[model samples]
Structure formats: C-alpha cells, structure tokens
Target: MKQMTRRKWLRGMFAGGGVTLLAACGGQPSGETTEEAPAADDTAADAPGVVEETGSAVTVTYWGSFSGDLGEAEQAMVDAFNESQDEVVLNYEFQGSYEETAQTFAAALRADTIPDVVLLSDVWWFNFYLANAITALDDLAADAGINFADYQPVLLNEGVRQDTHYWIPFARSTPLFYYNKDIWSTAGLPDRAPETWEEFMEWTPQLIDGDRLAFAHPNSASYVAWLFQGVVWQFGGQYSTPEFGMTMLNENTVRAGQFYGDTTNTMEWAMLSADLNQDFIGGSVASMMASTGGLAGIQESAQFEVGVGFLPQEANFG
Candidate 1:
C-alpha cells in the first residue's frame, strides 16, 4: 500500500474529525499496569457505548466517501483519535463518495453490521431520515448538554419530516460562481462577474461564438434544483412548506423554469456536459456554477486565472 505523507496524514485526520489509535503491550503480564492506565480506564467510563460492543470501548464504525488527498486527511483523523485518549475508538471505513456512502448505508441497514455513526451528504440526509435509518440525536443532545440555541437554527436544520429532527446537520455546502478570467478577457467581457441573474443571462451571449460554451454542464437535477430554489426565493417564492409535505409551484416556479431552461434552450449559454472540469480546463467553458467545496479543486486544476463569487441572484431577494 502507498504511504500517506505526513502533511496528508495531518490533513486527513482533522478533516474526518473522528479518529483513534490503539497501543499494544509487548509480552507484559496482564496484571502489570502502565503509569497512565488508571487515567485511560477513567476516561473510558465516560464515553458512549457502541451499538455492537458489550463494554466501554466505543468502536464508532464511520463510513465516508473521502478519496485522494481528502481521504488521506480522514485517515489521519482516524489515526489521531485512536492515539488520543483510548476512550472512543473510531473504526474508519471508506465506503466511497458522498453518494456512495448514502447508498452503502441504505443497503447495510438491512444487515447486522449497523454503524454507530455515518457521514452523509447534507442533502441526502432526507433519504436517511425518511427511511428511519438515522437515530434522532435530540435526547442524545440533551444528555450531552448541547444547546441547540448556541448554533444557527438554519444550519442545524436537516430536511425534517413531520416535525422530527432526524439527523443533525453534518457536512454542508453552498453554491458558488466560478469563472475563467482569461476566457472572459479574451472574449472581451467585463473584468468582474455579473452581480444579478438577469445580467449574467444577458452577458452569456457575447462570450460564446462557436462551439465553445459560455457555461459548463446544465444536466444535474440537484444543481438545477438548488438554482431554482435560490432564484425563486430571489423573486419571492416559497419552495416548500414548513412541514415539507407540499411543494408550491406558483408563478415563481414558472419563472425559475424559464430562467434555468434558457441557459441551454434560449440563451444557448451552457453545454450539456457531465465532465465540467474537462470542459473548463480545455477552454471550452467560460464559467460555471459549482459547490463551495469545489473551490480548492478548481483552483488547483485549472491552468487559467479562476475567479470566484457568490451564486448569482435577482436584484432584491435578501
């Protein structure tokens, strides 16, 4: 196996947050005690008991889709936690990416191997909650002395069903604007990005001439849904009810559809691409909408000058 570098190890460790290390005694008698053994025993008494375990050792089997440098960072977190204090031992498992982790947990719940904790994509928390696969941590929170008021109410909210807090908000991401400055300058556009959605739509036409697309992929329902929500809110529309039972597809929905659909249909600004990064790097795409997590990756991979901005919105939604 390839060895993870020291820097990568440190990064992975902090990123994953839950990590552990175990130490072994070398041929010492079972009765013999190390100087710190008493402290370790005391610490173990306070930790949460693992579902599969009979005793104090909390083997928190966590699955995540942390790959590449990010994966290494998570491994480092695991190793650090295991080496920390010997109270909770986190057994890290690489199930695959965020989507894969969700899928794996879905399948695994049918079996005997139920993990104590699982990392899931923030959006997909709904699926887990709907299926009743995740434990409601409200009582756990109370027991642990966590006050919900201490955090942002919106941030703490995972898509709830019927007034039940199914999953505590884990990893979160927001949309962002990514543009190639070189492409923009070459195309004789403004130095900075458009401030409004209308402005952006208008600007797209002048940027593209032939097969080169003004924007990247436009196929992802998730991405489109996000934009639709944001845009509709900009124009004053409620996406879903507080109970989330009914979707309000009013005039705002029609406007959102028209605006988003025009990216490919009317404006011809975007290409129907799955390999957005490829198109961007190849200089075929001038700009794109991507997740906040993609910032570092885009910066590292793109050869051209990349500019970042908040997701484009209407004039006065906020």
Candidate 2:
C-alpha cells in the first residue's frame, strides 16, 4: 500500500477528530509505567504532530460546504479543535453548497492551489477518487493507531473501495418527511405523517389553499436526485444496479417519474420551489422531504411545531 505522508498525520486527524488523533499517539502498553526520560534529540523533534521541529504550529487550510446554522456549527468544531491543542492550527474556509464546493475543488485541482483538506460530499468523493485526486486514508489512519473496529461498520464501509478506505462519513444523513404541525391541525388531518405518499396525497387537497401548497418540489439543481432516489425505490424500482446499469426507462422508474410530474403538472398539488426549506419554515409549504440533518436548523428557525416521520411508502418501502 502507498504510504500517506506529507499530509498523513493531519489527514488522519481530519478523518478522525483531534481528540482521537492525539489519544492514539500514546501507544504505551496498558501495564507499562512511565520511566525517566532521556534528553530530547533530532529524532524526538521530528516526531509527528510536534511543533518543536518547525519552531511553530503547522497550519492546515480546510475548505467546507456549509453556511447559516450548519456553518456556525462547523466553525465551532474547528474552533474547538484549534483550542484543544497547539500542534495543528485549523484554518477553515466556507465554500458554498455541495455542488459549488465540488466545482471550486475541481478548479483548485486544475490550478494546483487546493487547500490541505477539502470536505467532499459522498456523491462528490467518488468522482475525485476515480480521477486519483485524493489520497487513501487507511495507511494514515493505521499509522495513527486508529481502530477501524471502533467505528460503525455501515458508515465506515461507505468510504471503503476495493477494501481500501477513502472518504470518511461526516454529517451523513437521510431524507425524512417534514411537515408543519399547525398546517396538519388546520387541515383537520391526523397529527402524524401518513403511512404512504398516496395516503398523504389523499388529504393534500385540504392542505392546498390560497398561497399554501400541500408540498413543494425542489428543482434538479437543489439535490432533488437524492430525495427522488428513495421515491424511485418506494415505487418498486431501482435507479441503477450496483455496477452502474441505469434503469430510468424501467416501467416502475417511469411510474415514479410520472407520479412526481403529476404533483406539479397534472394534479397541481405541489409547486416547484426555489428554496423549499425557507418555504416550509415560513409556513407557505405545509410539507416537504428534507435531510434529517436539517432538524436542528428547522427547530431553531421555525416558530411552529415541526413533525417528522418516515417517508410515505407505495408499492414498497425504501
């Protein structure tokens, strides 16, 4: 395996966190006791994560895709890490959305001005991996004495390719059905989310009023694909095989697409939205599907009670 050097220790720290990285540095046996130390030398000075070698802390530039409430929280983590130790100083820069961040990263790669660490979404990391633009973390993590078994297998495995780990899961989440409880009560419907999209749509008419829509559809540019993937599966279809054989034209997939089109075009229940989050939080849209990670921001911003539940099912549940 290729060694992860130059940026190895820092990468390991980023993959893991500051606390875990530093803790792993003390590899003394459980029963071992401290002994009198010898005088410091060049080898001791050259050790990983030591500032004495360069007479100052190493500064690492990190590019991330987050803003607003999530952005504030991201900065908090960086501040905590910076304050936690003096060996490494994290310099964070907020890039825009995932798409924008990926675009900027591509440009940076071409210009050779990339930051020391760039946060890549799961969907974006594979492209970079195929282009050989990023390094493998297994070696760096191993050198740091990280225990892979300590991580949740499902999440830990997402970054593994051909048995080699690359992109670690950070802020990972899934789409959830979010609704305005106030609207539900006003509509005279059940207090909880419907068991199925069809069931939900049955009462959608009650939700559609003057300026209030029963639901909203984000455009393709706003990550509708991620949400739609679950919808496609719920309709008893698969977008593609594991090996990448697309099945968009498959009967079930087409049915799922038609269902979406009818909501905005035929049924006229849901309208296309530029900012669905704002719409839902502002009470203009009664319901929408969004990431679970949005829970905190929504709770903080919305004045009304927000109810969440599993996405409605259809021919099958995803």
Candidate 3:
C-alpha cells in the first residue's frame, strides 16, 4: 500500500470508474476482478468520446443503500462514468438501508458472491475490517494518484487501524441542532439556537404548544446510540478509549442518562419519535438534533423557516 490523497481516491472511485473487488473468501485471491461485459446498446455507441472497441468493456458491481434523491444522484454519477469511458462499465445495485446492506453483504460473504464495491456506514466498516472482509486501498489509491493529505485529519483517521487503511469516509457528517425559527419567535424565546443544554432546557417550557413536544428524541436503534454519544461527551464522559480496552462508568454518564430520562419521563418536555426530521418539519416538535446530511432534504420539505446550530454543550465540559 502506498500513500495517496483522499480527493484522488474519490475521483478514482467514482469518476474514473476504477474499483477493485476484494470479496471475503478465506484463503482465496483478493484483488481486482471484473465481471462479464453486458451487451452494448445504441446509447453506449452514441455516447460522446466513446469509441466502440473490439473487446468488451470491463464491468464491476457496486452495492449501495442510497434511495430517493440521493439514489437518483448516485445513478446519475454511474451513468456519467459509463458514458465517459468505453473501457469499463459500472453496475449499480441498491441494497436498501445501511443495516440491510450489511446483512446482505454478510450473506454474500457466506455464498461467495460479494459485490465488487460497497458503501458501508462509519460504525459498521470497522467490524468488516476485523472480519477481514474488506481490502486496504493504500496501494490502489497511490496507483490512482490520490493525495491523502488533502482529506480532513479526523475524517481520514477513521479508516485507519494499526497503521492500515481499510475504508474511506463518504457522506460524513456531525450532529446538528435543527429547529423551527417560527416556533421560537412565537414562544417569545430568542430567535436563535440555545448554546448549552441548560439554556435549551430553559427554553423548553415556552416552546411547548398544546400537545406539541418541545423536543423530539430519536428512538431508532441506529440513531439513538449515535446521538447519545454527543450527550455523553457534553456531560464530560468518554464513551470508550480508542484502543477499546476500557470505558468510563462514572457520574458524568449517569448525569447524561438522567437528563435524557427526565426530558420525557419527568419534565415531559420531550417525546421519542421514530422520525425526528418529519416531526420537526410538521411542527410537532420545536427542535431536535440530527445529521447534517439531512439538512438539504429537510429544508426542501419544510414549510416553516428552518434554523441550524451547533449541538448544545454542557456548562463546564463544553
């Protein structure tokens, strides 16, 4: 494996139409492999700059979980790649949600029919690495002229383990505090996001309307833990050491938990929602914490003026 930049890696992965498949086959060859070429159509021959060669174009399957507008965007990218080159043809497959994609990949591993490429979640990619199910892209990236230094340190560091790079950040995001500015103004509260958990709590009472919740907590298994990490951090607690050797179980953790529990169970200020974005957009909740990746869609669908801010901090910890 050799050093490369993240920008070039992304270009090679998408625009350049180059991806090496390393299936999870024990003791089997794990390198670049291509699939049989599909029959070319009139569109292929008509594509600009594409010359019909004697040999069939190399094909590779890519599994991803994007749907809706994101799915459409991904398809457009595949189409552009296929039209740009006559040497390679990309086969795009929609494999459902991230969890479902993992399940399908696991089954494919057992059947020895894994896709050539996959889009994995940040939380789940490490498990695949531990299972020896993915490949190190360092050499391949270097060959593609990737400049690793161009990538943000925190995002690039997520894929490294014991000095080996097994994954690359895609669709990376941080939790953002999203709120309805109209609701805030109507409640006689400041027309801005609260800077701390205490300030947010103080605003909760005014934010509530009849049956509407001041805040909505995500209850889905995939999101609950991710959002809780921010709360735990704000309370001055570490989830676990990077080495995965030890985790803290102190007052900070307890305090964070109690604060959340009180929001719904005692203060009645918040309620759990399976879809926080929808709830906020529908005016059922005043504010909530969600991934920044959803901001575009939320803004497009929302009827009210939407406001975004950094996640509220704890008094001393932040």
- C-alpha lDDT of all candidate models, in order: 0.57, 0.68, 0.67
TM-scores of the candidates in the order shown = 0.76, 0.77, 0.79
lDDT of 3 by residue, 44-125 (tens): 1111211123355545577877777878988998887778666566678998766666678766665566665788666555
Worst 10 residues of 1 by lDDT: 20-29
TM-score of 1: 0.76
User: Candidate 1 local accuracy as lDDT?
Assistant: 0.57
Steric collisions counted per model: 15, 0, 6
- Score residue 33 of candidate 1 by CA lDDT: 16
Candidate 3 shows a clash count of 6
Error of 2 at 33 (Å): 57
Candidate 3 RMSD computed on C-alpha atoms after optimal superposition onto the true structure: 10.3
Q: Which portions of model 2 miss their true places by more than 4 Å?
A: 1-53
Candidates ranked, most accurate by lDDT first: 2, 3, 1
